[model samples]
Target: MSAVNDTSFNSAVFLLTGIPGKEDVHLWISIPFFLIYVISIVGNSVIILIIKTDPSLHVPMYIFLSMLAVTDIGLSMSTMPSTLGIFLFNYKEISLDACFAQLFFVHLFSFSESSVLLLMSFDRFIAICNPLRYASILTLPRIAKMGLVCALRSVALVFPLPFLLKRFPYCHTNVLSHSYCLYQEVMKQACSDITVNSIYGFAVKLLAVGLDSLLIFLSYVMILTTVLSVTSSTESIKALNTCVSHVCAILFYYLPDIGLSVIHRFGNSSSNLPQVVMGYIYLLIPPLMNPVVYSMKNKHLRSRLFKAFCK
Candidate 1:
């Protein structure tokens, strides 16, 4: 494995679905993605507005919610334009630089979203376990700090991807599988082997993804124990229902991502469709489903949102 550290190496070219320069998947891809994008934006925007407009929602939970809406918008903005642009112009040629840019931003927003979720878990923990201290624990400054930390963490961890990719000379082969430059696919064309890249990627997942998830798990565990100690079945049921949407969102979003990662790593090519389905499920589903999940369950916020829409 020779090290091809050519900083100026050009990215290789690849065709979509084996058709050289054909945008045949444009309409089929664009229509669905566009619809989903609109839904995501609107749903998230409404949630944000409701949270902001309603004084009743000015709590830690809703602040985290507003952060989620912002993150969802950023998430959509990061990925949707290039995707929609590719389809609209029927132009499928993505340069190496552009591909790396997309990958970095995608991961950046993804990391932010995960961090926000972790903060939310802590929010719920404080509300449930130490209700008396909830306000002091999650003050405006604390919340602001959490958001800042997430933003900084995202930029810090994700900013390194493009730089690492730079270490490899893209001798050729820019054929990206799927609409974007999926990491494994681009890394596959490394003129120099990216064993370290694979390691870094795994380490990122372990630290950022794994540790964030572990904290969420612990927060929930404490919440569950506290709820159990209530001894009132009615209170337990009510608390359970209150967290239903968030719990479902967590399970649905992470379950598909975990599934896709396993299949992509271990399964053969015959699993491409499932992998593809899971890809959309991983990216689009959370943003799409999140607002709906919260709206359907969160009566106070949802009622305000509906009232705003009605007016």
Candidate 2:
């Protein structure tokens, strides 16, 4: 593949990279990736279906969960085609527009997922700390409005990314680091001055995901404090029990994400294999595991899922 120098953004193409040194076994590798995509799709879809069809789950917590399922599905869809294409078909060439579009949706859903998790944290906080007001505070219309705000925030922040990258000329190798596009990976490929792109990208991640994480942390802190203040041990246990699934969700999503970011920023350049593995773990595991976590933790959801499967 030739280097892209002084090329128009519309005409430029990027070669997506599969696992380093594992190109010969890409077909074999695709089996697990394909299964991941299928399970993520089916799992999140089932979660959404159960939430939507079950009148009993029409509360704030489950509403946020349904939103999360949708975001997971969106994230899976955003990465699936290019990822599976590279591994299964050796179709690694991606057009500039398509790459940018994929990056946008991937980050969009990712940020929105963080936001939904924060919202869920708040849901738990209110439900546990101030149970009497929970119904008044998190009504359906209010939840809908909150979801809209999260969607708009994600779009508003992510929409400018493609345009910002497009303004820069890529005179270096256009081969990307991952099978699917990422903002940082794509920005590194540009030959021109990327100071603005780098600053803006960092700022966006800090503002969106970083802030959401901080708030989620604070929400949990308050939750724990509230639980401790309860006079009855049974009440405390019940309150904490309600948060088990959400806590699992948070850990599954953020731990891998934080590890991936650390690997990207500080990892050795010679270790492409670890970086690629972390990327897959960061992107695929949360979506694949969230439904399972929720199903196992929530008795109602577990029963519904079992009935659905048995049927």
What range of 10 consecutive residues in model 2 has the weakest lDDT sum? 1-10
Residues 1-311, candidate 1: write the lDDT tens digits: 23343434653453322122445666776788899999999999988877887788888889998888788887787777666767776566767777888888777777788888888888888878888998888988888988998899888878788888866776665555455555656676787879988888778877777888999999899999999999899988887676787787687667876886787788676535666566667778888888988888888877887789799
State the local distance difference test value for candidate 1: 0.76
In the range 237-306, model 2's lDDT, one tens digit per residue, is 9999999999988998888888878888888987677878888888998899999889889998899899
- In candidate 2, stretches whose alpha carbon ends up further than 4 angstroms from where it belongs are 1-10
Residue 8 shift from truth in candidate 1, angstroms: 8.8
Q: For each candidate, what is the lDDT?
A: 0.76, 0.90
